[model samples]
Target: MDSAAAVSFDANGTIGAYQIGVLISCVLLGVTTTQTYIYYSRFPEDPAILKALVAFVWVCEVAHAICVAHALYQFTILDYGHAERLFSRLPISLDTAVFFNALIEQSVLGFFSFRIYTLSMKLYVPILIVFLSSVRFLASMVTFIITLRLPSLQSYNAHWSWLSIAQWSTSVVNDVVTTAALVILLYNRRTGVRRKTIALVDKIIVWTIETGMLTSATAIFMIIFYLTMKERMIWLGAFTVSSRMYSNSLLASLNSREALRSMNATQVSLHSFVSRPGIEILQTTTTNTVVDITAKFPSQPQPFQANRQCEEC
Candidate 1:
């Protein structure tokens, strides 16, 4: 095989990295579908705006998957044995995929920002998050436009590297800020709470950290790979999967409400009877089972009261 062909298929090179990224992203798309389904089925009564956001993210993800698959097909199948085509202008599908990715990121980040607002009842922090997210999205869109005009992806790196840096740096900063804000707010809420409520708050903080870390870590590595190894498309691999992480994180957060509520109820039930054994303990459940962390952990802790059916028992 010629050197070009060999490099094209080199496991440590561009095509190889892109192929692997595509495979992982496709697998995560399946996960996205499942999470979307779970969110819709379980939380039918969620606020209309929240429901719309989930639907919009899912749709964008599906479109992104299709675009990514098309790009892969063009690279590996349609342009087989043509090394020049691999380095040629970007595929339309790939360009569209980037746009979809930006959309997904913006939506998910915005949703999280709103959640922070709900939790803290403060707009400054959430507003900052939204601002960062908007900048990232705008930069991505500008980059996408530039890619269309560039003769090759290599030329893009040559001319407008600063734009790429801006886009990715804002992304990393936004993720870190969002995660930190949620954790700090939740941690503050943890104070002056009983063991049961603290447990719930701790669980939420963990989830926020985990989800934030996954996306933030991916963004960090993406910029690193791009800056260091753009020639081999290593960054493309990370880019392909990054948007999916945001979507999954959002859905996972929404779906976890049920579990959180169940946990709170179990903790309450267990402790309510621990103090009064052999008493007929009848617990009344609230209809709102959805996990609203803001409601669960109020700015001021409310005294716990149990509605007992058998006070005379």
Candidate 2:
């Protein structure tokens, strides 16, 4: 076969799609690893289970990157220009690599599940989130099984696109539910809080929405392209990097807590009273502003530690 004919069975766009996504994912993976290190370095007080979960996330990401790299190696380098092998049989490595997508996503969702539980203290919301997450994971698992069963990539798409649809749609719904829960909870708590406390909570709410959107939007794009660009694998390509977005969002949330807390501390300190003796001390200015953090996070208030911390800040 000539050069053009060699790559014809699968278009160049389809061939390049996974490679491009893997490259993007690898870059974001590096960012996530760095952010995880930063979170550990900054917050040694974080729970042991939380630390273990972070390590698990790292391992899943590394394994995912390796799997995709190997699949690409099989497609492009190891079997270069072998159209029959490339086009006729689906690589099992791709099956494993895409399965990692479900793993990575569920890990992030698990973390958020606990967070939603903590923030909302409602069992039903977390239960629903967990159920949706499980649906996504199971859909991906079924998709992988279908990939393994089918020899042809074309045939697999024809047979199993429904599972991909189910997975991506579940992810989008889960993210939307989680984001709405967080934002609503935060906004509700801000009602009776002080100015500084309200500002801090507002910042939290913004980050909450932003991080939620990152994953939600990525999954939405994946599903849209999956439906529209059937031959190109554009959606699958986006799936590679989208997991990193979730990890980065979680790490950012963890790291930002400390940074924002410290910064808020400084801002609070600036309000301290100046010790200057004056001839006429009839009027004095006191910059120390007291806050009731119980009123800040009304449901799960850390009155002694958090309220006093802000007061001392």
Question: Against the true structure, whose TM-score is highest?
Answer: 1
lDDT of 2 at 229: 81
- Over 166-196, each residue of candidate 2 has an lDDT whose tens digit, in order, gives 8788889999998998788667755433456
Weakest 10 consecutive residues, lDDT, candidate 2? 275-284
The lDDT of model 2 is 0.69
Residue 161 displacement (Å), model 2: 0.9
Cα error, residue 209 of model 1, in Å, equals: 0.3
Candidate 2 clash pair list: 271-287
| TM-score of every candidate relative to the true structure | 0.84, 0.82
Point out where model 1 deviates above 4 Å.
Answer: 1-12, 264-290, 293-313
lDDT of each: 0.75, 0.69
What's the number of clashes in each of the models? 0, 1
